[model samples]
Target: MEPKPATPLLNKETPIIQSKPNKKDFLNHLEAYLAKRDGVDKLLKISRYAAKIVLTSSALPETLTLTHRLMSFESSVGVSRKAFRLGKFVQDVNALRSSHFDSTEDVFLSIVAYGGEGVYFFVEQFVWLVKSGLIDKKHARRLGLMSAWAEFVGYLGSVSLKMRDLNRIKEEEKRVKMSIEVAITRGIKCEEEKERLGKLIEKKLMKRFSVVQDLADALMAVADIRDGKGHFLGPLSVSIAGLLSALISTHKNWVSC
Candidate 1:
């Protein structure tokens, strides 16, 4: 038609070349990952419990020497991770100072959770010092017991708070669903509202995973509080719980990173 624009001189289409990640990109990503304190701590935690699991498993051969090495590695990692928490309790205090709650129950639970955690972390420094051989080992058991109890209380408060928040989220989700149904029934165009509600629901669902992590940590705390002498919780059970907690924490940290 109409002389076809005088014929193109050359092909105008350009080839698309996909760039792959190189060694420099990988090193940059690894550096970013290790830069976050929580990310590194969670990785170490995962490694520690994974080692414990392998050490306790019967399927491994020459486990005596392996177990000893694993135990040493695990212990060292545990102590090192505590060093990351030197001023961690200040975060809890700051949170408490900055937050405003809707009810007295929320305030009480927040205090219990954050306060208990603060105490636990504060006590943990001494325990860490003991483990590091700066303090006498004789105080280790008492300090450790206190830390475990505080951690258990913190977890209890955390679980309660999360349950309350979950209930509220569920109620909100129900309201949103009903609204969506009504809107659809009335032939209303609310695509933006529906999308917002969907994202809210997704966020709430992701938050529910934290409860599982908390429960697993609570189990480990119970084991620590009892010095691993509980009937239902043996070395294997504790190791499994620790691993579960570590994996959940690692997932959270990785996603945030």
Candidate 2:
């Protein structure tokens, strides 16, 4: 046999490793981290708080409606009228906290044991209501029809099923988050997930939100002008609605949530 060719002392290597960001992998890792931080486990306490606040506020909006309907019912006896009107609504408000207890999220169970900041809750009340099939499916379907983001989450895994269906929720949540990030980077326009074999989890589960789509559009504009995440340029038409809004809203809710 001919003598083996002499091997080069050093292997030729490419600097492609440093070429550009592997956004896919980078984002995957980021998603995993955010999921952990935003998880049912780490944020159960926050989730319950968020659930309570949202539930109460949502019901609070119906005060006038409750008063009108009750007067029509003629059950205004011994009812302080205003207080009575608000009382029933208050009870309904409590349902917000009561609904979130003993829930779960895919691999984890909620910390809330029964309608509170307990040890068995994970998802929120509205989500729980949706999960327990206690809400109006038709209304939810209507909400879904408002936008594609709304549709996928309607009458299905939404907040309603997210309690018992943990894995599906996480996968869906991640996809929406990523897509929102995409919209944020795309020429200043608003924007807009899944899974089977863990691989498919990235496809079938995520459901984008209309609110997020609007935010992404704004973020994209910001990035375009500044060439970065939070920078800005020109007259900066940005307001308390886009990234600023998301930041403020999440900040307010997160602290309280």
* Candidate with the greatest TM-score versus the true structure: 1
Record all residue pairs in model 1 with backbone atoms less than 3 Å apart, i.e. clashing. Answer: none
* Candidate 1 local lDDT, 178-205, one digit each (tens): 6665665566766655665666666576
Best-matching candidate per lDDT? 1
Sliding window of 10 residues with minimal summed lDDT for model 1: 9-18
Q: lDDT (CA) for every model shown?
A: 0.79, 0.34
Question: How much does each candidate deviate from the true structure in C-alpha RMSD?
Answer: 11.2, 21.4
What TM-score does model 1 achieve against the real structure?
0.84
TM-score of each: 0.84, 0.16
For model 2, residues 1-257, the per-residue Cα lDDT tens digits are 99766543212431111122235465665455445333322233333333333333354455577545533333222111212122222332354445544434511222121222211122223333443467665554333223222222222222333334445557665665455445444534432111122333322232233234334434433443344435443223332223343343343333322
RMSD, candidate 2, Å: 21.4
Give candidate 1 regions above 4 Å deviation: 1-32, 61-64
* lDDT, residue 172, model 2: 63
